[model samples]
Target: MLRGLIASGRLLANRATTQPARLSRNLVTAAGPTSRCSLPHTHHHHPVAAVPALARGMKVRSSVKTMCDGCAVVKRKGRVYVICSKNAKHKQRQG
Candidate 1:
């Protein structure tokens, strides 16, 4: 019983009185991928010279027609697609 009490006392005496401040890890760097994007890469692990503005996607929607000048509504495989050849960001799909 005396040994147990001494060991508990020793453990309490060795502990730090104050906790250390936590580090702030929310720093954003310009060199990070979020700041700048590299060239479009293919699934084959090959980097392409450029990502075509009109990337084929099945999610093109009809409302995206006025988003770009090169937008065109295309029908493929019984589905509707809004394809923008000039700007790939405007691509949308209609259900």
Candidate 2:
């Protein structure tokens, strides 16, 4: 039902208003439209932030933590986390 609503655009009603909150180009700071601004060639555009090239290598475990090479089971914020500093690939969490 939730997927159907999202696909039908009903769940996206709030997204239309939230897009400006993460806008890459700021209208208030950027130069006005070319037709209205006197300096049409001098547009004040802000550089977009570069995205980090990282990978999502987390696993969702059905049980709490693992006994991997260096995994440690820990409880935090009412949730369970399995962190492995030596083998970061074996990191996972469950709640």
Superposition error at 42 for model 2 (Å): 23
How does each model score on TM-score? 0.36, 0.38
Q: Show model 2 residue runs off by greater than 4 Å.
A: 1-57
CA lDDT, candidate 2, residue 38: 36
Model 2 over residues 1-95: C-alpha lDDT tens digits?
Answer: 98897786964777876777656345534655443433457767899989997875768777865767688888889778888878767778783
TM-score of model 2 relative to the true fold? Answer: 0.38
Instruction: Locate the minimum summed-lDDT window of 10 residues in model 1.
Output: 18-27
Clash tally for model 1: 6
Off by over 4 Å in 1: 1-64
lDDT of 2: 0.71
- For model 1, state the Cα shift of residue 11 in Å: 4.3
